[model samples]
Target: REQADLQRVFPDLYMNSLSNVLTQGMNRKKKHEVEALAAVVSWIARSVGANTVVDVGAGQGYLAQVLSFEYQLSVIAIDACSHHGRITNARAERIKKHYAAKMHKSRSEDRNLNMPKTVTCRVLSTDTFKTLSDSLLQKDDLQKANLTGKGVGEHSLEGLPDGNVPSCCVDSKPSLLLAGLHACGDLSVTMLRTFLECKDVKAVVSIGCCYNLLSEEVENADSQCGFPMSKGIKSAGLSLGKSSRDLACQSAERWRCLGKDAGLHNFELHAFRAAFQMVLFRYYPEILITSPAIGRQGKALRRQHHQRILESTLHHEESAHSSPSLSQKNCKKKGSCPTMNSAEAGTAKNKGTFEIPLSDTGNSTPKSCGAADFASSILEMDALFRGVSFNQSTKCEATKSVDKYSLFEKFSRSGLCRLGLHHLQDINFAGLWKETEPFAELIGPYWSLRAALGPVLETILLLDRLLFLQEQGNSLEAVMIPIFDPTLSPRNVALIAKKI
Candidate 1:
């Protein structure tokens, strides 16, 4: 209910001290997530007296391996992706072999190098949400388990070598701890519902990610829904739009690495695209009929433009007689270089600048006609579009109408097939620059403020799931805990609930 660090919530669980051989190779992010989630699940298992764990969306069986091998718990890892099951099975075998080798060395007397049934990977035929009830423990599965055996008993490895392990279901109700590490979208919600419906599931530790993939209740069935689980929030009509949900999934660590300048560049890039759209609108009035989805294509275009600009600046500075090699040397040494400012760019004669006029007037004035470099840039842009096999008719029209978009129009139209370009027809370099300067200055802080509120959004979503659990009446107590270091894993909070 209140803010608490992950360590504060699970103090008993410690990191696994893996020897060199047993240290399975994984990236730093994965290593941290596995260690932290293992600890939390270990703690939850102990608290609930649960030995069997059901891991949904178990990619490569990393968490399952931790629970079964490290924590000495029985685990069934389920994923809809069949390919992942093969990888999981392979990893599980490797870990088992490593453990066996270690055990054989320590105790030469015991020849029973039989693998532990620490974990089993299963490919789910049903949807991820239906996995709990439809694909639970079977009778044959219980037989394979040797469930009656004492602590740390050897589990059968009969069918694992070929990756054909059957789903194990218990006839009598057995205690279960359901877990999902970064279960995307509706999968996490499914786990919450499973804990409520299935009495055997004693506790749950769900850490969700990819909020953008979540289905809106109004648009989807109750079974398929991912948001507005709590009655309070549901009654208040709370909803996170696609963009907001996508924003919620952003990592703070990545933001810190980008710093202020790169972030601002990205913001300014959007306005540039918007202005470019206006240019297209003037030439092609048809573009205004609908709103086209530019999406990441605009970002890519902006990045290319930015890169071209940098190259141009470096080239110009390098060719100058006085500062012939100064710019090049400085850029190479310090990874920093002077770039042409917008103010200077507007006045530069032979450099590529946004000096293209919106008017079709045949005036000889310099302001009415584009610079040679600008015209060349437009030609280069057009060549790039042609390289991608974009529609030639649209390209011809764009070129015939305006010299500025000679090549740029096809690139923009290829990505944004809708009508948004019409509005940008009137926006020119000077006016767009004037409009974007203030916006560019303020956007960084605005995005940061929005990012600061991400945790609150995460909290609300997790709490809603917890509230749903409480309302189920099966779970005695349901609470959300910060189970991982926030700096390491942005989506660190986990919803944990225990049965009566």
Candidate 2:
């Protein structure tokens, strides 16, 4: 899809109308989304004659604020996270002041901003939407104009107070338009279901992320699964296991954009993480069942790795300044001396092929790794063995025996310490690296090819959503449009539908 698709479809009423004040706190990527989406949805609300636009999963109220203040349309900002609701309210106040100043409106005149009503409630099922419809419609809205700031509410759907009314308080029946930006997993699917079930909900414009987190019926028959929302897939028994769903979120463009050094570093990190599963399997077998995910230990390892280099550099500079170092003098005479480069040192190993022995043959032979299978297995292993608490570590002999695994030893020890594995006194990380290191060079090429398949999964999932809307009967119109730059926002397509 072209980046200009959004701009082309809606020419006269579009992104350019946004100001710096409106776009504050948004980065380039977010700014692009808000500007493009706000314009299109604004035009949609107008075209469809929707009085109130309800933004489901409205984090920080960026889109809601734009619709309420700029477009002068009433809006409801609903989010499950209470903190997001709190933040959205705070952000709304700031934008109100900006708009007031821009338009030269008095406190009494500020009612024209039509500040979005903040609702902090979970949209778990269609039942929530039914309750929301009742709560909003049942309120007395004649005094909404007079209430203004007083009417801006953080009300729950269970009940509304006489003193508190909604900012989008309607005198007549409401035309509810549902929306979500990066609504997580089941929440996005929940919105589509709501749109279909609730008569009051006339339209829905949704963009979702976190496919990995989406509930699957195959995983658990009890919980409602977000996948296979379309009847066609449900009948076909198509289930993308969480491992593959996580892979669906990968970006081909992001990988392509990486420079050689950065890319290779990432590949090494992946190999180390895969090897981490071996550590878990050997020392803490039971922990795999528990699936204890200590947050971002890989990222922690990366941070620690960089910190060591920085500290070493500082110590070397200080030593050079304090005294006439022979190494420094020799380095000046013979150009800059290089630090140990693992890739260069392992040139011989990289060329060697790795293989898993076949059970019947009882012979070892070189085997080419299938990129998809390798990525899937590695991802599943990481997911299974994650959050390992290897709190205790034995002194690694591998780092001293062979310099290749010095960094790997650090990574493994850090991982072991996190998993609290103390009894592994003779864990030979070098042997494990020796066993698996031959496959390290193959990771970059294999993973790159695997990453390309991400969109195929994404497309099928999106198609399922589209088919769901279509199968609901011809009374509703549905379309999935490529609205934003896919490179900037990988989940760029918006699922939009309007009931006839």
What TM-score fits each model?
0.61, 0.72
lDDT on C-alpha atoms for all candidate structures: 0.57, 0.66
Model 2 C-alpha lDDT versus the unseen true structure:
0.66
Q: Candidate 1 on 313-427: residue-level lDDT in tens?
A: 4665565556846645543432122343333222323454333232222122222223452343333332332222122232113322333232334334333332322223343
The TM-score between candidate 1 and the true structure equals 0.61
Clashing pairs in 1: 137-168, 137-169, 138-168, 138-169, 278-424, 278-425, 282-425, 287-419, 290-419, 382-407
- Stretches of candidate 1 exceeding 4 Å from the true structure: 1-8, 18-25, 108-135, 139-173, 218-224, 252-258, 265-442
Compose the digit string of candidate 2's lDDT tens values, residues 1-500.
44556655656665556788878899888888987788878877776777678898898899998888777878888887778878888888988888778677544553566788887777778776656655565343423323223234676543444434334434666787888888898899988988888777888889988999887775343345688787777877788988788888888766776645446667776787777777777767898678755345545434444444446446556756787465355344311221212322122122343221111111111122344333322332232122111111312122222233544554565454455444366677778888888887888888887788888888888898999899989899998888888778878889989988
